[model samples]
Structure formats: C-alpha cells, structure tokens
Target: MRLFLVLAFFGVLSLSAGVLMSGDDQDVDWLIAGGLFGVALAGEGARLWLRRGRAKSHESSGI
Candidate 1:
C-alpha cells in the first residue's frame, strides 16, 4: 500500500513536470506518455486503498 502510494506520487510528479514543461524541451508524445503513466499508477494506488478498506470492513463484520 505504501509502495503503491509512493509510485503514484512519483507518477503525479512526472505528469506535472510533463505538463508544465516549456521551451525546447516540450514534446507532445512525452506529455501523453507521462499522463498515461500517471493515471495507471494512481489507479493502482486507489485499488490498493479500496482493497484495504474492504478487508478491514470484512474483518470487522466477521466475514
């Protein structure tokens, strides 16, 4: 879970950098790739979070 969150954080940083890039360093393909990578990492992080929540709930309910 913590690992996933850390990956998501790095992904977000990459995406932000891609979007905010300017001058001669900007590339549309790189921007799109970064955005996709960020989304994927964030989705995985969210899945981990939801799975953790469901596990806790089930344990509490004696399921």
Candidate 2:
C-alpha cells in the first residue's frame, strides 16, 4: 500500500509536469499523461482511506 501511494504520487507529479510543459490541448501525449495522473491520485486516495478505516477499527477493538 505504501509503495502504491508513493508510485501514484510520483505519477501525478510527472503527469502534471508533462501537462505544463506541453504547448496546447491538442497534444495527445499530455492528455494521456493527465488522465493517468488523475487515475493514480484517485486510487491512492481510496487506498489510504480504506487503510485508515481498518486501522481505526482495529484500534477500537483493542487489537
């Protein structure tokens, strides 16, 4: 999970950089990069949230 989060964060950063470097929206490369970044970010967020919920439950159970 931690590895995934790191990868996703880096993916987003790289994609954002690509988007900024591109001259315009007509650039297919930049568009694809942006889409990949969005997916990575969403996946990371969902995983983190699920982990947090599980941790909370475990703590409440005195495990």
lDDT of 1 by residue, 1-63 (tens): 777677767777776666666447665347665776767777777988999998988775556
Q: Return the top candidate by TM-score.
A: 2
1-63 per-residue lDDT for model 2 (tens digits): 776768867786867677676767644366667777777777778988999999988775556
Clashes of each: 0, 0
Candidate 1 to truth, TM? 0.49
RMSD of 1: 5.6
Cα RMSD of all models vs. native, in order, equals 5.6, 5.7
Error of 2 at 52 (Å): 0.2
TM value for model 2: 0.52
